[model samples]
Target: MAAPRAVIVHRTSELTELLARHGTRGQVSFFLEQRGQSLAAVEERHDRTRAALADVTAGLPVDWRRASVERGELARSVFEPDDVILVVGQDGLVANAAKYLGAQPVIGIDPLPGVNAGILVPHAPAEGGALAEAARTGAAPLCERTMVRVRTDDGQSLTALNEVMIGQPGHQSARYTLDVDGRSERQSSSGVIVGTGTGATGWCSSIARVQSPRLALPAPTDRGLAWFVREPWPSPSTGADLLAGLLHGDAVQLRVESDQLVAFGDGMEDDRLTLSWGQRVRIEVADRTLRTVRSVR
Candidate 1:
């Protein structure tokens, strides 16, 4: 049997030592995340780092390559399946990369303040202690789902970590139609929230709170859970009260009979979907699972 291939992801500092340990015998590859660094910076840093790794590995047979791609190329390059890719970046970069890369095993090596130390480890650890156990036995843990594109009216598509939302499309308060399991439901509201378990922390949580308050305390599933409400926040006597009310529903439908409104994700306008008063908008969990790599610690 062949030895499992491992990829060392690190800045330059720890690269040499990693290569010395992993590159001595089996197949090894190196992926260096530039982390939005400028070309000049990466070149200068890679030069020093690469030289150090060469010294440590000496005659060991290792295939080393730098992941040199522009910012726009990130989604395409990072998402592919490979042996193993180590990453050296902060949480944000790791999260974005994980979104595209199918949740492969990712090791994060946070750069020191101004001083780069490339020690690599998984990005986020498993929810419990599962990751730690896997690492102890040299096993890699995979996240549940990967990125997916959903089709909507007018040949439009939306990428989501949780769900696709449609609400007061445009500047007018959104009105839309909704159907659950093929049964039509009339709705009037700001918009609709479609999300997966991963997105529950953001809009999904908000929508579900209003639609079916009970879903919040339970674990999410692939079947995709959702709810519907008849109001949008702001009419409440207090902001705290509004929030409290919003969090208690399963899904929410905002009533906007006047002008169109915009649907947002993580707070940004995602895209426009037709909506209106008395219209029912559907909100549900997606069928796809987004895979992620978590640490054993």
Candidate 2:
């Protein structure tokens, strides 16, 4: 059998991007000066991220096979069932990597823990080596996070860790028919969002905040999903009665009545499914769940 592999996923630092665009530190300094920002602060952040990456790389077990890739290239990356994933960035990085991963155990490491909220990145760089080993050995504690799955009748489907957005690509009102729990309504609004328990704190929470304080959202590990329709414009032909609700067991179905509608998951706009008028889509809980490593301490 082959030794388990580790794939470290990261994004380029802002400092590197600045230097790439300006071609020199002097140019970067001038650009920052124009905005009243200090280059030293940016450099410090860049150094910290570099140090974190170095720490994670140096701590890996010598026998383990290791590879690294950037966030943008995740769609092209391949992973084996035995591979372990290490995401060294903010919460969004982990979310980005989760969609492409199957059953691999993921260790979410915050490269700059002090500056980041690290909601999804529970591990720090110093712990990356240990977490990587634990994942390889099947000893790491894991939390199964539910994901939202969206599928079009034409055989297109995608999953989201946070939430799935179904609406117009250019911020215009999206006309559609929403069906949930045997109740259906014709809706003419901005769009609809269906989110998993893991997504309750994000866009879902913001929508829930306005509806009612007592509207309880699902926990991160729960199998349920919450949904909301943004700015439903009630016209003589359309009704706004079915604006918000929960979806579990039965799928929430939407039929596009507009010229074109888009469905994207986890805020990956570049990766999306386009639906034309007369197309129908269903949103439900995905069979696959994200196996995220939790802090052993």
Candidate 3:
């Protein structure tokens, strides 16, 4: 059996990226100033994030195996059954990490405590140590959040804690035949987003808001999913009648007619699947859930 491991998942601060791109602090300051921004604000946020990380690092038990992964490296990171994930960034970071995890419990540590949005990342950084210990000892309460999965006929699959967007590149309309329940329709639309209850609050909610009655979304704990087709174009050969619906105990299938299309989750564009014409894809609620700590204290 693998030893209990604690994985710290964090995103690179914007200031750090700016410094790397501009080659120096002065250059970064100059670049930001040109855009009417202040370097001080960015630096302050960076310092606070780093301080949070330091406290969390200091709190880890010496006997526990430890590792850290940046946001960009999450898709490539391997997670074990006994691992405990400490997400020390925004709530979105939890979403980015959730798809890769199995049953391992996650602790969301907001680098900035008071300003917390109380979404996914809800804990203060100071609680990292005790939380990990509690999780390892099986004393931590767990909450399950629903997720969605998309699989291609080629044997490739992707999971999302939020939603999966399958579309053509560069705003070009995507051509595909969509299948739901027993009905099917040929569609020419911007894309399709199949989302879970957790995703219903973000992109899915915004997308549904544009509808007349505003589509109802599933709850974070619900196994069902809600999906939408963006701006389905109406024409002689195509139909927009099947634009929105729910997925419960059923999978939504799409066969691509476009030359190229891609599917990505949670706005992580770099990690995506590229599909070709004549490819078939299946989307449904996933078997795996994002297991998170129930309480922050």
On TM-score, the leading prediction is 2
Compared with the true structure, model 2 gives a TM-score of: 0.96
Q: lDDT per residue, candidate 1, 160-259, as tens digits?
A: 5544555544433334434444333334455455555555555556666666677652233344444333354433321111221222123333333444
Measured with C-alpha atoms, the lDDT of residue 28 in candidate 1 is 22
Q: Model 2 off-target regions past 4 Å?
A: none
Tell me the tens digit of each residue's lDDT in model 3 across 97-148: 9878899999999997666565788788788999999998989988899989
In candidate 1 the C-alpha lDDT for residue 85 amounts to 45
TM-score, structure 1 vs. true: 0.47
- RMSD to native for every prediction? 12.2, 1.4, 1.7
The lDDT, on a scale of 0 to 1, for candidate 1 is 0.40
Whole-model lDDT values for every prediction: 0.40, 0.89, 0.90
Error of 2 at 138 (Å): 1.2
